[model samples]
Target: MIPALRQDRGQAFPIYVVMVAGLLFLAFAFFAVGQASATRNGAQGAADSAALAAAQRAREELGLRFPGVLTAPGGLDDIFKDEGFVAAARDEAVSFGAKNHADLLPGGWQPHPGRTGQFEFTVTVQTQYTVGRSVIPGTEQDHAKASATAVIELRCGLPPGSGGDNAPAPPPVTITCDGQDVPVDPLPKLEKIFTVKLVD
Candidate 1:
């Protein structure tokens, strides 16, 4: 009877080992699922933040000069280049776990001038995901995209229609160093002229 009992115990050891292995597998699967969920949440937060930053930058650029302010005399392209809007958007998106390629993020914009006393700035950022192992070997990794639009207040030292009411205005002040009316240029350090404000 003692020898038979020992044989039974030895056979049961294999079954116990298999059961433990199965339990370990299940725990690992649960951990993976939790990790994937956390990753997605974090990635989504990053996307929203990046989009907002880009849009804000675009809005600031649009409002600068803007035909009313004499601080910076130029067009929208100057502000776009000076503010580095695209680069900022790409940097923000890349900072949030987008590391598939060095140039992983691509950003673009479309200007929609507001007709109702506001300015619109639309920014779009696209990047490839970098979550580990979630993208299976045979399938392509997920793509992340974010977009945002910002409204800017166009105000200067004067209010709207300050020059006149439904009438043509006179010529603006022009600086002259020699014979001709030399255009006044803003300082190079003057990059962003729009101030950020929070309204209730």
Candidate 2:
């Protein structure tokens, strides 16, 4: 009877060992998946932030140069081609990407297709940190990347006859929005004039 019992215990021990080993492997696999997901989410967040920051910076530039845009000849065309405008936008993109633990790839900031005159910007970023060692192979050296697009669309408009060739706009500019008057000077009420958002 004692020998029979001993043999039964040995058989059960091997089954238990196999079950524990399988469970540990599953746990490691799940942990690796979680790590990968975290990296991907971080990359996406950085891209969205960088794009929005760039668009917002461009919006501010427009507000600062709003007076010239209204009175200068070919003003509408000139502001779009302004080197300073593009530079400011790119600076903001790079700054925001760094803040979010990512790097904006070269030429990663570009204009959106079929969407001219919207102050549109698309930003792409790669995570500064790689996914750490995991159960999955090659994950230790993997870096996540993501892209997002944000736009600064004009929401508020100037007063009637405030725009056009050689038409002088009156100030302090009284822009109306949501049933209230927003002043456009001493900072041009830019937030009121433009809506900044992530489109992609």
Q: Which candidate achieves the best lDDT against the true structure?
A: 2
Predicted structure with the largest TM-score when compared to the true one: 2
Q: Which ten residues in a row have the lowest lDDT in candidate 1?
A: 187-196
Pairs clashing within candidate 2: 184-188
Superposed on all Cα atoms, the candidates' RMSDs to the truth, in angstroms, are 9.4, 2.9
What's the CA RMSD of model 1 in angstroms? 9.4
1-200 in candidate 1: lDDT tens per residue?
A: 99999999999999999999999878866766665565456545544554445445555445443444332333222333343444444454344324322222344454444443334445444544434553234223543444545444332232233343334344344432223443334412222333323221
The CA lDDT at 107 in model 2 is 73
**What are the per-residue Cα lDDT tens digits for candidate 2 across 30-125?**
999999999999999999999988888888778778656655554344455564776888899999999999998877889642244466788889
Looking at model 2, report the run of 10 residues with the lowest lDDT sum: 70-79
lDDT (0 to 1) per candidate? 0.44, 0.77
What's the residue-level lDDT of 55 in candidate 2?
Answer: 87
TM-score quality measure for candidate 2: 0.84
